[model samples]
Target: MTRRTVVADTRSFRSDIQGLRALAVGLVILAHAGFRTASGGFIGVDVFFVISGFLIIGLLLREAGESGRISILDFYARRARRVIPAATIVLVATAVASAYVLPLVRGAEVIKDSVWAAFFAANIRFSLVETDYFSQGEPPSPVQHYWSLSVEEQFYIVIPLLLLAVAVVVRRRAGEAAEADRVRVLRRTVFVVLAAVTLSSLAWSIHVTATSPTGAYFSTAARAWELGIGGLAATLVWGRAPRLGRWATEAVLAVGLALIAFATLRFDAQTAVPGSAALVPVLGSALMLAAGSTTGASSTYLFRLFSIAPARVVGDWSYSLYLWHFPVLRLCEEYWEEPRLSKPHLAVALVLIFALSAASYHLVEQPFRKGVRWRPRLRAITLYPVSLAMVVVTAVGAHAWVDGQIAALEDNPGIAVSDYGRDGLSKDPTVALVEASVLAAQDDRPVPGGLEPALGSVRESVAPLGDCDYRTGTRKLCAFGDPDAERTIALMGDSHARHWSPAIDAIGREHGYRVYVFVYSGCPAITFTRLTDGGRPWTECADFKEWALGQVRELHPDLVVLANNAYQSAAMKKRQVGALRDQLELLRPLAGKVAMIGDSPKLPKAPGTCISERDVDLGDCLQEPETGPTRIQGQFRQTVEDLGMTWVDARRWFCAEDRCPAVIGNVVPLRDREHVTVEYSTLLADPIAAALGIAEG
Candidate 1:
């Protein structure tokens, strides 16, 4: 193997950049720790992206300038050694710890997440999960923060190949040219490529952020421009960095810091990320990096402040700190009932994070990083495969543990139908089964066997919408149950309405009514909608609704049923009521009849999660009718009834004696906190049929 040398020695370390790392990690930790003021602390990852691009690109350019070629093998070797060691340890540890701490269902999810994180595809996995409507309400994975690392690792791969491509093109164009000429051409070509990536990705990021913010948030394509901007800065500063005066440097640093501070303070989770808003922090980080690379900048007070010993120390441990803090905070938050940790709990988490990070830095990160330095052989690159294998083995072990638990539970005796009859709970079998389960729960009896969909897979038992359930404005007509029937029934709403599809389809089949289903994620079918949850114009949902309503009109459905989440917005109360009225009035002319399916009760804890716990009191999974959200839903029911449309009270299907159980008729009711599972919904077909006055076949 050919040997190559780095252009700069280790002493060229920029304490200012190190301080910047400290700042970035600090912001992330503060945000995760629930510091309300630092709601936009997520910009810290943007800072890190810029820093990584500047340092890595600058190093590669210097090596290319010196040797007339860049060594892809050596570059990858360093990256593998620097990142893979600490990352592997964290991934494996988080997976093992999750299996012990989380319930079987959630723990299995974490194990799968760990595998994705280990292979640096966690962002893709998470984006897929987020796009799945059923997984919307699931808790964040312990290794969720690895998504950023995955982005960086992906950058590491693409950048080297990109630079090599630039080198190849420069050599072909400037054949037999002097080394200086070749270097100059390489630099210019690299700059153009970097600029194009930055601009094109920025435009795409803005578009995606508007249309699909969750997808944009985790997308490498959307985030690449941030790193590209940093690369552009590095390209400009290489071999010809400005020698700015102290005052100029201070002014630049001050402006950069101000921009970052403004974004950190003013932005919140609702901010459209990696979009136009992201320019604030990305540019801020780029400016600071550019200024710091100048000759006289280090003498500036602002520079010295960032170069302080404490900041430098924090920066040294920043990588390990970033890796450990999220899982530590997430697992700790799991034990706490509140959405955000209390100050005392946060303090404890910080202590644990710092301690674990310090240990990881000294014990794992330092050893591997230094080992690579002492043994700079091409064989060190093999660490990539080895590290991945270690993580995979750990994930496999965790999966085995989860599968073992499922098999054991499967062997236990199941709750018999005889129990329902012996209990004499209700004449209706479904109602009776639910009542019996509730009684068994109240008595603190062991979790019975033969639970439908099983707790381990219950989270995934959502009503299957095939390809028709749109997450965006795009519409696809999906018909069920006697698609050729003359009498058509239109079922329309957001995911809340979707949960009732199984029962409605079953009823439609029995009654010879073709069901046309139109369900969009987070989109309420009611007219007069104006804004999305992020306060942007809800053009997509509005267009979808118009298109769906037009289709319903064309079909001339016999009955049009509209349903959505019943959880009331204190502010949108009047608007929601008015919208429903307008929706009914509009649909009255489009169909023979209009009906509204009342919202089902929302559980405090997700039934899938609640039932997974050892000896969990199933009664705790039940919700009362008078809960705030349920009361609000009831108010909406009254409004619907007052509008002279048949209102199917769906609460009656799930609730018995004013109490709604999470599991009914041996099936998990809600997949998450609100949407009912397909199995439970199927069991409600009889009640739904009676409610709609559709005589069974």
Candidate 2:
């Protein structure tokens, strides 16, 4: 097995390739830049994959034709030099910024991802962490775009070695036409892999669009097919294929650009992934690629347009722009405490990215890749380790910086969690908070007659009847069943109400029970009779109950329901305790057969914290709080014992012992921020309904 070296050569990067790069990167830039015309602009990444496959394979073909060997190490090392340095710069830079920007609970997760990206597992991490793209108001991670780099890296790892093995076989088998035969085998392999991956990706993409939209959008399994399409384009470079004619190419590029423009303007993450809609731009790109300027036809208008010197410059610097813009825009958003990008912000981002990508491409990528002043040894051995070191060092430094920032935030001259209520607002929003656990167990504070002091409403103590529900916003109420139907069971509470509603609704549909949800975002099932600790009437809460009472009086539902966390956050003060008692007393007989839905065991403050820190299998976030209300269980029992209501304790649903898994019944226990995601809620529908006696009815 004598080793042969393929002398690296320069086949001019066709104008069409440059134009395609311009198109792909432009789509991505416009979409990411919040350009309204390029909503589905991410399809550009698929185009980039095709362009990469074409370029890399073209290089491989050129080598095989010239020298009988494919140098796997040389190919990989070149890739390392070109992609690693700039990427590391972006990663390190973003990691540092992330420390100051993201919340501490989330900051550490981003730092962990930074390490994963440095190691080339970003695609996998994102697949697990960020499957949903439609969740509103979620923050962006600093290294979000690295998912594409992961795809490219994963491709490189497999393609080079496969190409090498194919080359080896051609070398041994082909007596005279080894070069041609070798290229054929490699081409076939690439085509086959692309075809397979394309099919799988398309299938997964379809599944995600319909089933799990979030996971479908982010996971590599659902996205790899786009890159495979590019790989298909790459395999076509060597054949004497009939060109699409200049007119066709131009029209396709124009159409592709148009489709992309329309998609950006018309579509959003809510529109779905890669379904029939994505084809408009992806195929359009393929057409422009086929209609090269080399074919002198009038149809090549867009090709010629993209081939122009300035457009090519934009294409050249696109990578850096893609990298720098997001970070700059994000950092600015964080600094200003704004969430969306503004026009001025976009202008700044574009300018910064242009400068950075230009400097990086010329000073770093070009200088390192082109050996005008350097040798193979210099390209492979000199630059690669330095780039790796920079990535690792920067990542660690950013982690430390983030740690310091969080510490600083804790000691800030301003506000903290205890300072504000559950909402990310400056004021409290609860009518009355009763810590049953503190009242029952801890000597720290008293219960219903001696609870803490936090008011619910800010203004208009006696608010209007219409704008009332157990929540924060204008439409603060989320109803589960018929808003106006007879034979009703009012499901009143927070997410627990949400969880129980589906089951109740299903049972309602089956057993002639109309379930009406008078649920707040996180507030529990207690009545609204007391003032907030701040001494304001809990108007919003009281209004919600009043509205329910009105509905009850009007329709004469068989039962009026109430449910809540009964979360006994320890250490209450005075009036809130008495208020709690009054609240329960007021609510106990809202219906002829009133019920209090008990709390499931609340997980501890954090995931995996109790086990790792407490050295016990206390379940995820679910801990037997030594100081607080006994989660949802004991509170329901207490309220029933005191107020004489039917107690429906759902505690048995989660607890098996002193240990209960955060997720029970093979479902995610909580969706996000404490409420169960729809999946788990749907799963637990039956038990909640039966427990509420709706199933028997």
Candidate 3:
């Protein structure tokens, strides 16, 4: 292959830009490390978006100006060199680490995520999965941070072609005109496009953020305006020299820094983001960029400080730092079982992050960008195919492994369902505890075949079919057990209610009852409105619940079972209790017997991981259950009694003496933190049936 020198463009280079990069990465690091003061530090991503727009668009404009046409191949090749190598390294490392440290189920998810990240489509994958960015209970994926990189990659793919199309249009319109006239037309076209994109996307951002903040955070359309703002600035100042005086430059820089600081300190998880709030950091970044472009501003003290070696060094490693930090933090939390890092732990994590980032930047990023000489075609042929092959192999292997485990478990049906031999209303916790101890004793023995991975296939065994689960405005009713039975039983609520499907289905099948399930993921069968974890009004959830209530009334089931994971706003005890009471009152008229099923005890982490990891002690995995009735349970129980209904506490099945064990009878009791594993749920059929005052068939 022939070599070509892609020399630096000194005129476009701004030393102070590196300082902005440092500041942005620093804020993100602080936020992820759990710094209370830097609540809005997530805004650093908006700043980076603006900087990326300014720099990339400026490069495109320069290429068009000097060469009289832009080279799409060359642009993409540069992008590949800058992004692919280090990212691939991180993805591979993360996959290997995840498989070793996390549970097989979670490890499988990370493997899939790594594959998506490798293709620069992680944002699409995350959006499809509906991964909530602000969820505290869910385990953080090692590659979750790749969503931002995916957005940037998607932008790079489109923007170049967009600019080239504009150039073609300008050339056609200015046929036989002077080169200067053609340039003027092109600049005007660029400005119009950027301004239009900025306004439209900003409007979309505000609307989406208000309606579905989780979706808004990941959607490219909602985020395009942040990048477009930078593109607009670049277009307006194309081929021009800054004319700001020394004091004016200082004032602008000071104001820009102040705006960034204000956002970093003031914004928290509850604050609506990437909407109007994002303007603070976006405009601040643009102001700094404008100030940096001034020719003599380098002499100013503020500018000089920003251009210092340390800031530039940090800026150079910013991309790698951003990639490494979150994974390291997540791994630390996973291993140590401590989500909140102490000062000493935070310091150690930072040191490790910086070291990893520095090595990655020097070894993978810089060498690929500066030393490698492969043409775009060669790189695409070699790099993409290899990366794709790695992804396919890993994903296939993971799926097969999990599938094999599930198949093995299917062969041994007795392991999951054999322990439910008890009869009547038994209050003895030792019955379940003794059974679980017998199961635990089997943990040390090697079986004829390897042990079946229960947690990995927990959801698939009992979850309502995906297409039948009601979401959004749609209403879906899944019927289990004897459809023509005289006695009808209805299961209603969110995922917490759905987790009980296995148990209810077993009871219905055995006792000649038809079971109807009306459940969604986040929606509870309650009267009061609730917001999503991201702080957006859960309007779809409200609509679904209304539809479900109507279905329950129409069906008029002999018995109605109400359950939900009421963990949100634990501090707001009174509100939660009142909501449950209102819900019970509504359900009373719908069924002959209304029963309030108290939530199962929540574990600190997924029981599967705790059981899988040899280093984790079984005792540490157990959680101290509530000593007294939860406010919601107590209030709902009182209301049920007053209405002459029933209250069944399910915690007795999972917990003994106010302490919940992670595993029972070779079964991982909880799937995630709160939902019971399907195997465990199936075992609870007898107890649940007795709670509803049903006689055995």
Q: Where is model 2 poorest over a 10-residue stretch in terms of lDDT?
A: 450-459
- Clash totals, every prediction: 0, 34, 1
Highest lDDT against the true fold, candidate: 1
For candidate 2, the per-residue lDDT at 244 reads 60
Q: Write the per-residue lDDT of candidate 3 for residues 1-697, one digit (tens) a residue.
A: 0012111234544667787888999999888888889988989899999988887887787677655678887777777677777778788777877776666667777888888888888888888777787778676688998999988878777788988888777777788888777777788888898788789999999888877777788888888888888877776666765778888888998898899999998888887878888899999988887777775577777788887989988888898999999899988777666778777877888899999999998888878777746544467446666766776677677667655543453443222223445433243543455344334333432111222235555433445544566754445666787777988999888888988988888989989999988887766777766775446677777887787788888999999998877644643344656677788888888899888777876655665655455444455466665433454566666766787778777766776565666666456667776777677778788877877788531
Q: Ten consecutive residues with minimal summed lDDT in candidate 3?
A: 1-10
| Stretches of candidate 1 exceeding 4 Å from the true structure | 1-11, 131-138, 176-178, 336-339, 372-378, 406-427, 472-474, 567-571
What residue runs in model 2 are displaced by over 4 Å at the alpha carbon? 1-10, 65-68, 177-194, 239-245, 248-262, 275-277, 297-299, 371-388, 405-697
Ranking by lDDT: 1, 3, 2
- Per-candidate TM-scores read 0.92, 0.59, 0.86
lDDT by residue (1-697, candidate 2, tens digit) is: 0011111232334544555576677777777666656766777776676556556665665565556578877777667656776777787777776765654434555667777777777777776654344333345666777777777777677666765666666666665665556557656755675577678777877665554444555566666665556446545654544456555555656776676566556766556665545555556555444444234433366656766887667677667766676677666766665666677766776777778878977776666556455446445645556756776787677767654543342221211234224443223111101111211122221111110110101001111223444343354443335554556676666656655565566656656666666665434445434443223354655666566556655544567566565443332222334444565566544565666666544544432212112122222244443324463345457746687666775554444344444323223334332344444445555655666666631
C-alpha lDDT (0 to 100) for residue 627 of candidate 1: 78
TM-score of 1: 0.92
Q: List the candidate numbers ranked by TM-score, top first.
A: 1, 3, 2
Identify the leading candidate in terms of TM-score.
Answer: 1
lDDT per model, in order? 0.79, 0.54, 0.74
